[model samples]
Target: MGAAMAAEAEYGRGERATPENWMYRPANGWTYDQVKELVLPFDWDLVDGNIVVRGMAVWWHNRVRNRLYYQLESARRRPYAVDSEQCIVIDDHNAPKPDVVVFDETGLDIRTVVQIPADKAVLAVEVVSTGSRLEDRFSKPALYAGAGIDYYWRVERDEDDLPVVHEFWLHHEAGRYVPSPEQPTHTGKMTTNVPFPVDIDLHSLIDG
Candidate 1:
């Protein structure tokens, strides 16, 4: 009984497969590669020196990611490429995988890229899900801003379950995210002239 009680110390409900011998910053930072090596079941992200389990993305959620990636891929100016579910490594201690990302391409190649460096990232977009609404709306914006990623967009669902785009840009002076004048909060569709002429039909994200 004592041994069983001792075994469940960290995560009380942990089972045999639960990892042991954890490490984090102030001693040494856990790199993305090391985290991947653990090969945990659920998707994980390194957040503020802790490993966080990301909520499972439902099909509709992923559909938004794919459609956004496609829309941005077609319209973005040169040197920027779009990808879905790619990890943006802000630093050794923080790496959150934004649902969609626009990154400065390394000579127009996505093949060799496995993880994106934050400095090369142009924008980070998160699609709010049932379990991730708070993180997507607040925590991740802070992290992205700190990494100097200039633009951030968060997508939330409307009453009819259509997409709503909320745009923001890093306020370098204040070190936080603020509404982007380039594009205002858009519902059902995103029609914008500034910030590089993005006109995405958000309603079409779902297949009829």
Candidate 2:
């Protein structure tokens, strides 16, 4: 893509559009060093004007992420990035950060400028957070589907309840994902055929 297109896309993908964190705000842009210092200690993630942090009920999220990370590694897949708070610039005006992004390893080499497009991400995961259910279950799915991503996972964790739910959706048709009917209930495994066929041990991965 052209530089202008990429910049426009980046701006749209929500990297703290507002003046929060005193870093990349509209009024006064803080230096990279300043932003780094402010963020290094906290579990905060900036997306456009929104600041997302680990929710009070976030222990489950950590468990789920760790487990998934382990499974991916064990499978011998060269995941380009995981748990990096991917702020996919969908457009110049909006961006949402996904919890995990799996891409081809070769595309993430820092020295290369002409890398694969963000739309080429193989799979994306969202660990549900308080006040984030809609965004995770709805908004993000639509964005990923529109971008032609092959897989999207919603990891639902609730320490207060049993049977920590893990929902899996696979994009079958363009811009749409269809959940299987037998829908792997708690502790069941599901196989996805899109992007590439893979077996996922849903129960073992999400229920720590």
- Tell me, by TM-score, which candidate is best: 1
lDDT tens per residue, model 2, 169-207: 555554675554444334455555433445667566645
lDDT of 1 by residue, 1-208 (tens): 5554454353322222235633222224455555644566678778875678788889888888888888887898876778788888887668898988888886545667668889898789999999998899889999999999988999988888888999998889999989978665987678764335688888888755
TM-score of candidate 2 to 2 decimals: 0.60
Output the number of the lDDT-best candidate: 1
**Candidate 2: residue 120 Cα off by (Å):** 2.3
Q: Which ten residues in a row have the lowest lDDT in candidate 2?
A: 26-35
Q: For model 2, state the Cα shift of residue 137 in Å.
A: 1.4
